[model samples]
Target: MYIRSAAAVSPQASFEALFTGAAGYQGEQLSCIEPDYTSYIDPKLIRRMSRIIKMGTAAAVESLKAAGLEQPEAIITGTAYGCLADTDAFLSRLVEFKEELLSPTAFIQSTHNTVAGQIALLLKCHRHNNTFVHKGFSFESALLEARTMMGENEITTALVGGVDEIIPASHALLRRFGLYRANGDSLRLVNEPAKGTMAGEGAAFFVVDTQQSANSLARLDALQTWYKPSTPNRVADGINALLAEQGIEWKDIDLIVAGRNGDTGDDALYDLFKKDIPETSFKQYCGEYPTATAFGLWLASHILHEQRVPGVEGLKPRRILLYNHYQQTHHAAYLLSAC
Candidate 1:
């Protein structure tokens, strides 16, 4: 599997949001500020779109356009909270109407698969479709599915994405549970506390194909998700295992794109066990999102194309490592070694 194209809309100036350079977001909680929906989506359909659908579809469409693909063989997406705006809206309506006169629009859009469904509707595609919402590993789940389908005889040009929208209720709830930063403060506020990872929301999508298209920045090297990261060495071992399997080692990698933010600067998940390996961190600019790593993959592609790394906070390395440690122990890592 390989990524032909990748696009994202996040709190920071991702995609066309770039002005001076892609920078970090220091808000209380990381949120994808969203791009101009009108530019990528039709005005007629714009008003009805919930944030999740609008952002998700927009990223997916840009990826397709970038890949020079009109239609994809499959649509796979990952989101911890899919169509949250619609979910919150529907619930609000249910409360107001006592659940009797509630419209089905919000309810239908709230499903985890709504993004995939809406993309299919607009693109007139009825191919294999799937969505994953496995907490922080949601996008990884979607990638897993795409990897399998890409190996199939008839499948090619698959669309994969990850998205999450910030909702007041859920954000508050997460704060209460210590899952998010209170008052949307910079996560570095608790960096020394060393127990909390920042809360973030975003949507990232890509056009993938089984065959190595000339347009592809780099092939899908491999993806790995872990239930528990007990030690720094353990996380490094996990990364090494994936690299070794591909007959590639850490030294051969041009860079390691990591999901590391200042908040978890010391979390063995961000910095590597081995200091010798070069790395690049982007969450400070893109903010923290479950799918933020998707952009890490995009940055990998960008570096491969532009032969330069975007301005990321703190770290000063050339090679990128897209390593993400979601929650305290549960983590996911993607090695975006240059092709």
Candidate 2:
């Protein structure tokens, strides 16, 4: 399948801005640099949608517009934490009001599949719509389903994405579990390894189809995911098998985009996996989250389309390999090539 158009509401100001330099974070969180909703959404509707919904809807609209399609045959989304702000609000109201005199708006939009449903509603696209929430494998699962539907001729085009966000309450709770450091730097996230990684969140969307369009970004050659591998060698074996199945040799991969989250133990596995494969990481730019690989995929697609690495100069790649895992589990690999 080919990724025809890709859009993101991430920490960086824009896609080109990321190549210039990553935005820095002072503490243990990297919040999104949100765009003006008046341009993408109706001002009245914007007042009702939560942060996650706004971000997801904006990316979906931009992706469809860029793909030159008013509507898609399918809308699929994956989110590890869905409508977290709404959920937090609903619970807080429930506690404060003692289960009385509470509005249903927050409760209505607190579902895990709310983003997919909202997009479908906004586009009047009453087609196949689904959402996956499988912890770290959320985004990979959504991509796999889209690929299967396209391969089976079930759908010609699909709108797919992964969205997640962090709130103050959730951030505090997660920090209590030692998920983030007390103080950190996003610019030096990968360069300076530590015991914990910063909390990051964003939304990324793509228009994918079997047919190549004029605006096609890159061809998604293959995708694979593994869960709970017994050892690191198993991960390597999986990578080798995927390459062999596609008749692609290791040398054919011009660049490897790895998911090194800046934790000493988490990054050690990446160091062992990529042995002199000219690998680079995206966590330093996007921070560490379950669906952060969606950001990585977006970056790789642009690299192949533009034929230039963000910070690296004068090196063009025809084929790119993207590998990411969440907490040493839920491993995934994707092979992308220039279209």
Candidate 3:
């Protein structure tokens, strides 16, 4: 039900082979430049894994190792674009090689479930293994499922994660569809801007279990995701619902971690609320990736454990509420109370 050990590989120089540290992004670009695969993956295994599979697998391994577990009862993942690099590579081969002598290596690894499958294979976990690919909510969806598993006692240990990779042709396609900007310029949220949100990519994995994990960093108070927001008042109402459910109050919290990615007008929902709760800004570090929210979650977990707010990461947060509004149509919120 709670994230005990969370690890990630993000564009911000967070390279743990499985976990990465806070590295800054310089441009409109956000990417996970992976750690050395040779170090974490077997050479024989390295040749076959697509980047998504590698990212998820490496994170899972490190997270479990950090939690001092051999394997989880279930492995679940969320991905906006699964094995995108491999899919693009296969498509290129399909055209360049005339689909004549195309290798199945890339194509075989190109599915949404490949990452989950590979983790299961490596861990030899034959229990619950599943994947969800739902645009931006992919990772959160996986996390929600793991929460259910924990509550039901169907599984005690669950490895849940989100992984996404950038693909050139897909970026071009997104640009054409107006999901991206024209000049490849960095986009930040304004009260009102001209265009849309920026594109970002990363992988975040968490070791979750029913047992009281000694490595537990944060205790999850609530997790919420919804579509169709009518007003800032509605969001406030949602926050109230969470607070009421958890017997928490607005001023009882120490920090707030917000995903205000500087979307044209999309982040307004959070902007209006921060005025009331008043925590720190997390998006400035991770940028506007869909799962960038994961960093906020991971940071909150770390903050709870350290019993001290991390420098800039905690500059404004004490109760650490992971909050975000995406695509102008989706809003997600998570509340983490210090343990």
Candidate 4:
């Protein structure tokens, strides 16, 4: 399958802004640079949507528009943390009011599927719709499901997205677990090699189809996920296996986009995996959300389409390999090629 079009709304002003290294993070949490939702959604409807919903919907709309699609045959989304603001709201109200009458709006929008469901509702797309919430594998799972659906001739085109939001409450709780860096320079996230990384959230949507067209940005050649590799060599073996399945070798991969979040353990694994291949990190730009690899995919697609490497020091790539892991357990590799 090929990506017909791609759109992203991240902490960066835009996807292009992220690609050019024009965006920066100053604090611990990197929130998305929201677009003008009113431009894509009605003011009335926008009033009720949460931050994640708005980000997801706007990204999906832009992706569909770029592909010249009014509606997709399928809407697949991946969210590690879904609608955190609404979830927190409903729970706080439930507690504060002592289980008395509560508004259903927050509760209704708190589920993991709300982002995908809202996008479908906005588009009136009643086709095959699904959402995956498997932590780090969420986005990869969505992409794999879409690929399988297309391969089975179940759908011609699909809107695939990865959406997540970082709320203050959740951010504070996660920080308690030592998941975010404490008083570290944001620009040096990948180089500092710290115990934690900056927290971030964003949404990225892509219009993918079985056939390539003039609007095609890049080919989704292969996607594979592994869990709990015991050793660094095992991680390398997994990548080798993915490349073998594609009938290619390590040398054929012109660039490797690594998910090096500056965590000492995770970066060590990445170093072991990419020791022989030219590699670059995107976490410095996107931060360390579970679905941040979606932004990595968007970045890789742009690099392949524009034939211009980002400011990262790496070879200009014709075939790109994306390697992402969560907590050093859930590992995924996505192979992309210039179309």
lDDT of each: 0.71, 0.90, 0.71, 0.87
Q: Identify the candidate with maximal TM-score.
A: 2
Q: What are the TM-scores, per candidate, against the unseen true structure?
A: 0.87, 0.98, 0.88, 0.96
Residue-by-residue lDDT tens digits, candidate 4, 251-322: 898888989888897788777765476677788777898899999998889888987766754556889999
Candidates ranked, most accurate by lDDT first: 2, 4, 1, 3
Candidate 2 vs. true structure, TM-score: 0.98
Model 1 misplaced stretches (Cα beyond 4 Å):
15-19, 181-198, 229-232, 264-266, 312-320
**Candidate 4 deviant stretches above 4 angstroms:** 19-21, 312-315
State the weakest 10-residue window (summed lDDT) of model 3.
183-192
Q: Against the true structure, candidate 2 has what lDDT?
A: 0.90
Better of 1 and 2 by TM-score: 2
Error of 2 at 223 (Å): 0.8
Candidate 3 residue-wise lDDT at 289? 57
Clashes of 2: 0
Q: Model 3 segments beyond 4 Å from truth? A: 14-22, 96-99, 177-197, 310-318
lDDT of 3 at 139: 73
Superposing every Cα of model 3 onto the true structure, what RMSD results?
Answer: 3.4
lDDT of 2 by residue, 76-161 (tens): 99999899999999999999999987779999999999999989988989999999999999999999999999989999999999
